[model samples]
Target: MVSRSRTRPITGVLVSLTAAGLLAGCVPGTSGAGSSNSAGKDTVVTDPAAMGKVTLNVLDTFSGGTDNAWMTSVVNAFEKKYPNITINRTSMAWGDAMAALPLKLKSHNPPDIVPPNNGWQSMGTLVRGGLLLNLDNYADAYGWKKSFPQSILSEHQFSTDGKQMGTGSVFGTPVARASLIEVYYNRSLLKQIGAKVPTTYAEFDSALAKAKSAGITPITLGNADQNGVTQPLFSLTDAFGAQSKISDFIYSKGDTGIAQTGFPKAVSTFKQWSDKGYLTKDYAGLASADAAQSFVNGKGLFHFDYSGSLPLKAGQSKGFGSFVLPRDDGGKPVTTASAAANLSISSKTKHADAAAAFLNFAAGEQAAELAVEHGTMPLLHANVKATGGDPLFADDVAIAQSISTNGTAVPFLDWATPTLYQTINTTMQSMLAGKSTEKAVVTAAGKDATAYAKTLGN
Candidate 1:
């Protein structure tokens, strides 16, 4: 995801550090629903009246930006209607939220709802540990399968031991659709240089060289957060190779592992750009500063990031334009996309029906409109119009539509394994430090991947 530098440092620390602090709390025990008579097991309450005066605890990482307001409104409305049901809200920095989630769920009391970022990374762990409720029966009964798009539905559903874990289980609901790795260019800069936008790898390289000749940083990449740094590399990898190859590397799906194919090529391309000075020298230490600011401030020629940054750029600067990252051969541009922020229910929640109703409303048309009004692109239905200050939002919507309709997009790599995201972030930081080789990074990644896969019994 892309955004201005306003994200608090505390949030970043929380996301990165919470994992270690919370892992110890995950022990098997009966939830709060258990009764005094049922000494060892949780009480099963199927009837709505049986679960009275419930308070649904919601934990989310949307501390800043439009999403924060949007979610607040939704929760407030849900509470107003169900007067007896209260929503206890807890907001944290994204990093902290991600880190603290697993530990919190393992505690004696866990939130009924969690808005995990688009991926299976943290959610996968919960599913594996049986912390999340299976929403399949509820989803089927409520006709959610018909209401949600296939891509969105597929993300929540997973298979374990050849049995589907979360897909039909209704464990989660998507909040928005996320776009990863689009190319944002400063139109004024391109016009000043009299350069045409590049549509192929060779042309892209030439464009970068031209920008450098004009004394402008060709690309604005902030790697201070490892995920920020890796996004551009992942985008470039998709541009240079086939989508299937990228997927194999990300998922570690084949017999030879992800390294034997285009994985090395992707690394080599990143190294080449770094060696040639296409990326800034201080990129490794750069945090998630506003990518649009770098380009709008004339510090860089182009910025690569999610569609979420569109409004920030339009509001903050003028003469900005964006495109789907061009393909290697210039045939078509492909991107990575997924259900943006999904809502999931805890397996231990007593008011399962009420919780499901709230999520259904959250994912429905009304909530989608709220997302569009807040400058977020909606994944459910494309008919809703954007209402933010960003004029370039239409272009972003078009690019997203093109990719969704004609291109091959996949989920983010970090989504596959529980620890792969942290490992990748650490490895990328090491590479940027000049202390790690591409081969070494890949090897370390493979070790981590193997260990994680074993947890899944793969």
Candidate 2:
């Protein structure tokens, strides 16, 4: 599948559903979901009314909480501007979306726009199955190549056989551009520990020591789902040297390995934090959401997570600050994992022109602003000032721009394989519980990394 910097406007309609709960829903109607207008796939039609009235069906994982509200807000404006098109949405919580999408793509009624998921199994599976459309036509038609940077667009491409990305077929346009990992700190907690946003590892370690001395949880981590540990691991890996190989390994490229690349510091950092009393006691038992909540609730000094984690405002999150974690050896900012949030059309979409038009509009400046309004940063290059209700939005935009300038954002470690997330989580769980050695964690993950290569037939 191809990757491009595409904008996303989506949400869960209901907040109650779990990822498992998402499985019971029927597949969305695929009956020519992208049904064509007479102008054909190559047609250029910008006016919604001129393209004729149509209802675009979207199935996505944004069904609950802020995601649902944020998406509704974006669509509200989009519909007002183009009175001819209506969006019929199917929502699932992120887990549900992740669980449900593989099956959804197999349907005769597959959605025109696939709900976005970054897993190799979910995205890579579809690309390999030939289920997603090759969006080169739309890319050319919309001048999307010029709209998004090549770095952002690279991951969306997949070889026809689905064995490669970064140079091949273009699949989807991405949006909600972001840094894969950022250290979000609770403002009050930082002040209590006498900490400033650390630009170097030494400063960060010093902050941790101070926070621990103050009897505050220096960091809060929830690993119940087995995925949370990877971010810190990623952050550690980013600071390690020759970090370009980290991305290379993630992309299944030339002789690169995660364990060899960044595993040592990742384990060392975790061990140091645990021994320093910097980690929340019994953190392995908590969920990522729970840990994030605790940090926001003032139980911790820092929460290492993404920009999209907890929404922060002047009154909320007890005052907040965020910064991209710096490497122990800084030269290029190491982005352990980041990608264009890919949004693609189905090959069977008959409404290619209309679908492409919607994508085109989503890729523009207005949606970029709308993204900021909803607490997600846009992937575009345009200047959209943060409204100041939340400063994190503005901070994230600067981070995203830094990523764009640097010309690379690596994939999350979990992208190495469907199993990698589980491995990292379980390994961290073992380490936190004092049941496994750090060397063992690295050894186990490296084995899986090799297995992932075999699975990819690379």
Candidate 3:
């Protein structure tokens, strides 16, 4: 169980994917051959077996406990499934890989396969530089559109101009579908305090107050690391706004999307909760994992964390139960955040057919079972049955289904800008510490978004 996609470092230079029609690059014929489409320019592979001997260099960075272990099993299974292909794999920690991946993708010898790191920094860089294989033809060839929902596949698509996301040619697929923000509560504490699980933000706020007045930490936060703060912040923001409007802003649909939006309201609520003594005051010195462990130890009443930590909750006290954060207005069930890390193919790969085959298998039923066995949510269309024996896994599946059905999955706030993760995390910490005001925090994020949008040529 883990978090996040990436945050971009500052670059004084900008690259353009639209400036030149990049499909005509040095890789192959304008229309691909082996896996080329019927038009003869696009790649088309009807059979991975026909591709013969192949070696795919895969660069994967999902390096954590459950995800890392499950990926290992998936790699073994995939290689076994395709005996003709060998996977030359190199795995790294998330941050280290993010720092090194862009340079590597731009290098002469790039990994044949790569994991999807969402946002402008990783995918956008590759897309803009024309270093990515447009997966449009392959999606049709592989029947991916029939298997994956548009809600999940939207994140993978980018226009050739790189001006839009969520619509256009398919880029790649992620390992599974999961939530980024959720309310994990100590059920015993709720029982002791005589508070029911909240279905709306008002009831939730009341529970937090009740917990605080009862001398329990209402919320356990680990802001010392700065990164984890976005989970709750994102949930709180989405709770106040319409999912569609907020999504447009997230997708950079319009200029004033955030100018008059729900973010400020969420910030105010966060600061107010801190002021009311409902949250830990020492969060600035805490690590997210340590904070989560604190919740598992039953030291805190409520902990907002990524669903990736759900299995970890299984090891904790037996009284833990989780819910996606409730909406402020009791509107439709809306998901504040979902999967960030995904899968992508390299433009330099020689075994496009085998690589595509590996990706298809990765998103298939076996991988779904692997996800469930590791205590993670499967894809929206995945056919998963068990829940890795964690009691909370069912509740997680319910929430994931809820979003897939009635609501939409929004991207995390950090994906809004290259450096916005650092900006928002730092600001949230100061705001929680009472050193920064709500206006300041919102202003910082808005400025980053505006500046980044210009760089994106929007």
Q: Considering every candidate listed, which one attains the maximal TM-score?
A: 3
lDDT by residue (1-458, candidate 2, tens digit) is 01121111112311221231322221233322122111234545655778788888777655665556656776677788888888777876555664566556565677777655553545555565555677777777778787676666666766656666555667777655454677888777777777777888889889888888888888888877664676676777777745567767767778877665776777877788778777778777788778877887888877777666663444673277777777777566666444434566766565666676766666667766666666665556546666665665567677776766676566666666656766776777787778988888888888888886775668
TM-score leaderboard ranking: 3, 2, 1
Candidate 2 residue-pair clash tally? 28
Superposed on all Cα atoms, model 3 deviates from the true structure by an RMSD in Å of: 4.7
Segments of candidate 3 deviating more than 4 angstroms: 1-40, 177-179, 310-317
Q: Candidate 1 overall Cα lDDT vs. reference? A: 0.62
Candidate 1 vs candidate 2, TM-score winner = 2
Ranking by lDDT: 3, 2, 1
lDDT of 3 by residue, 1-458 (tens): 45442333323211322233322221223232112212123657757677789888988876767667778888888878778888888888765665666557656788888874676655665565555677777788878787665656666777666666656777777665564577888889988889988888888989988898889899988776675577777788778877766766766876655645588898888878777888776777888778887887777888887765643533652467778777888886566655545777777666677777888877777876777776667655434554545556677666766655553677665666567777877787777767878889889988888887886678
Candidate 3 local Cα displacement, residue 100, angstroms: 1.5
* Distance from true location, Cα of 387 in model 2, Å: 1.4
lDDT for 165 in candidate 1 is 26
The candidate maximizing lDDT is 3
Compose the digit string of candidate 1's lDDT tens values, residues 1-458.
Answer: 23422111233433433453322212355321111101112333334344568888888766876768877877776667667778788988766676676667666677888765543455554554556666766676567787665545666765432123223344577765444557888887888778877777787778898988888889887776654655676676667667665555545455446565345667777777788788875777676565545666767888877666643433553467677667777767656666557788776665677677777777766776666666666666656666645656666666555544454565565555456667766776777678888887678767876775554456
